[model samples]
Target: PADGRPIVELRGAGKSYGNVRALHGVDLQVFPSQVTCVLGDNGAGKSTLIKIISGLHQHSEGEFLVDGRPVRFTTPRQALDRGIATVYQDLATVPLMPVWRNFFLGSEMTRGPWPVRRLDIERMKKTADEELRAMGIILDDLEQPIGTLSGGQRQCVAIARAVYFGARVLILDEPTAALGVKQSGVVLKYIAAARDRGLGVIFITHNPHHAYMVGDHFSVLRLGTLELSAARSEIGLEELTNHMAGGAELAALKHELATVRGVDVEELPEEEDLTAPVPASSEGTS
Candidate 1:
């Protein structure tokens, strides 16, 4: 990235619950105009890391820094106050609310003061429409219920809202997990749009293909540990997909399944060394 300073940085960041550690010594950097992708299968500490970064959970072990300041956050609002906005997978929206209403739900613009104040509906509608267009998204209408829009559109609306609210770092959790191939592409397009607008984006997903399409940095986790981390120039999509899928492990599993099917396991392809970027964490790192 052209920007030398990272908007968000994690130094040996880890989280633990009771005796079980969900993350261990994870180092990451999020720079403006770049998408830092965190790829991992289920239970790979992605959720735990997201919680810590979003202020839903504090790191039990290491450092979380925002804008060169070393600080701990106790709530999501604190993270938001620092210009780090998160768009969750379940979405923060009311199904029956109009697109504009959902766009400005918790942070609605108001007119007048005290008892005389009311929602500035028209201004919000105009702003929402404009912001979406600014991000290269054009909606037919803002009066339609948000639920009436496709999943891709709703996710795009949430992303547009985050960008409009002055978010400097955007953390998106599985934005394309529920969508089909086409809809996933739609979300990816907006993600690129956000990056082009100069926001540091943290995109969390298990799909390497989707991540590769727009990511500038990649990190893969497995069993709550950071298994791989590298710049886009240092890694390719196939290597990333292999890491997330456990390249050698998957091959071994295939061997076992082949035996049950009465097929010769010896014919299975041999696992090759996929090593390139070093693992971000190792045993007892934290």
Candidate 2:
């Protein structure tokens, strides 16, 4: 069942590096079993926001809350200890390792007499397989290197691993940025699966289309500041895309393009089809 309350919240959060400000008074809330999508262009402070939420960097200002209780973390481990897990674009998996090994990369299982501890490979493999299947991921070669799987498959494994490890909040950075249409669909499905299982999912991506597909809440960032934040019911896809592209900026761009190309701006293609695809380079990190 969905947890109706927010698991994490940031009020007036800010960060800086030397003289340059990376984030400015950003406020966000992540509810359990709901997908909160953060959309922004390059240099929009998206990375800085992720770092702050995932505990890689402390905000210089504002309140950080966990379950409405004020809290602060000096390190990523501290956040993870609170059941917050960050799955970055690279995903933090070793491609050459087997699926099971990657599933339990940092937290491997061990069982034996105290003096002769040994990895419980069989048990780990069985658990990994079952968990992946439960997430609707079907992989025939559990023993194969994780690199053999597609981008979406690797992401599913990473997400399933986080759930298996008892993560209550999962932060994903562009989980589907580097896949074909079909592959991106697969990743989106798994994201929904994770949300359905009651995890607060903070999904950071530049692609509004992907965000709209899985997000229940939307936050747009531009020039190191939050542009808009609202529930899904409050806005439609066109509004979301316009906001993400700098609503006014996009309008100007459209006019400029039409003028330069000698076409009627109003006669341009349907706004519905103008939604851009996820960038190829936006693929998750390994």
Candidate 3:
């Protein structure tokens, strides 16, 4: 599966909202059994790029490809039809609904004829339990309200739902943003499971540690533009965290601060020495 072409690819993708350009010339590829992470602070065009790929919005420039064929999707259904599914931070589930009900909310199983048609509750419950277990998730009861589950559990439910529905590509938006250490670990485990199940995962997040945990490829975005892109072999945790934390721009600020304090900037303790070229910043003092 890894030897084949990417499930989806974006070539110089760009998006514009009238006079405002939210994204520009961005390239990304999602291959089966690999997690591709898009890391950035807020307003870094993560959402914009997601929209373009998930079919919520169209790319104004460049190409969006599925199975190496360029295409434009007019609606979310179009994207879903192409086996691309996006699971957002706030999962679209009825909080008060039972876990089994939520699992098959829109695509529920049915039985009997039109005169005596009825929901296949037994089959739904059994399938939901089995699916969750397959993803290494264990729920005490499927009858409980979904709202009673923890953030990570809820995220897992959404992921399982997506996987069960035949999604070849899964785009997760900040899946672990609101989770604690243990909760985040749970989510990351399922993400790895999804990757192992041969789904191309695009994990969008601001946390480098979380991204680095399950990511095979990484890309950083700054102020709606790409800062850096690299495969796992070409980068490390320290380097990934550095880019997420502003890289050289942050070094310049620390250098300026040390200079202001009359402390030798060279001894300020950084990956880069004082001689390294750091672009001067007027806002370093402020």
Candidate 4:
């Protein structure tokens, strides 16, 4: 199933609103069975790029391609029709709704005549259980409200649902942002599982550790521009982390901080406890 062709691509992509340019000449290629990690800090044109891919906004310049052909999607539904599915941070499930109900919310199974249609509750519940189990998710009860599930569990459910509905491309936005250590690990496992199942996954996040764990390709964005792109083999965790923190810029800031505090870099204490109270300010002292 891995033909090595990109499922989607953006060449020289740019987006602008009024006189403000949010993105500039960004290029990305997403292939099946691979995870493409997009890393950027706040105001780094991340949201704008996501909008362009998910059809929430159109690019003002450059070519958007699906299966190596140029196309412009007028709406998110249009992209969805082409098997591009985006799983937002919020997960999009009704918290108060039962797991099975939320699983089939918009695309519910039905039985009986058209005018007298009724939900096929038994079938829906059984299918939801099977689908989730196939994704290695074992829920205590399918009848339980989705609100009762943990954040990682909810994210897994959303992923399983997207795959079940025939999504070939999965766009995940900050899937592990608010999760604890253990919960984040759980979600990362599922993300790898999704990629292994032959889905082209675009993982958007600022966490280098999380991205480095499962990424096959990396794209770093900064200040409305594409700063770097590399295959997994060309980069390491430390290098990726430094680039995200603005490499040289971070070093410059550290030097400035030490200078202002009148501390010789080589003579300073090796360990400064961040939890300790700040020393008194010497603003007016000689």
Among these predictions, the greatest TM-score belongs to: 1
RMSD of each predicted structure: 6.2, 4.9, 6.9, 8.4
Local error of candidate 2 at residue 72 (angstroms) = 1.7
Using Cα atoms with residue i matched to residue i, what is each candidate's TM-score against the true structure?
A: 0.91, 0.88, 0.89, 0.89
For model 1 the TM-score comes to 0.91
Candidate 1, RMSD to the unseen true structure = 6.2
**Of 1 and 3, which scores higher on TM-score?**
1
The superposed Cα distance between candidate 4 and the true structure at residue 182, in angstroms, equals 0.5
Q: Could you tell which candidate, 1 or 4, scores higher by TM-score?
A: 1
| lDDT for each candidate structure | 0.89, 0.86, 0.88, 0.87
lDDT minimum window of 10 residues, candidate 3: 277-286
Model 2, 134: alpha-carbon shift in Å?
1.2
Model 2, stretches more than 4 Å misplaced?
Answer: 1-4, 250-286
As a whole number from 0 to 100, the lDDT of residue 118 in candidate 3 is 93
Against the correct fold, how does model 2 do in TM-score?
A: 0.88
How would you encode candidate 1's per-residue C-alpha lDDT over 152-220 as one tens digit per residue?
A: 999999999999999999999999999987788889989999999999999999988788888899999
Estimate, for each residue in 58-111, the C-alpha lDDT of model 4 and write its tens digit. 999999999999988889999999999999998899999999999998999999
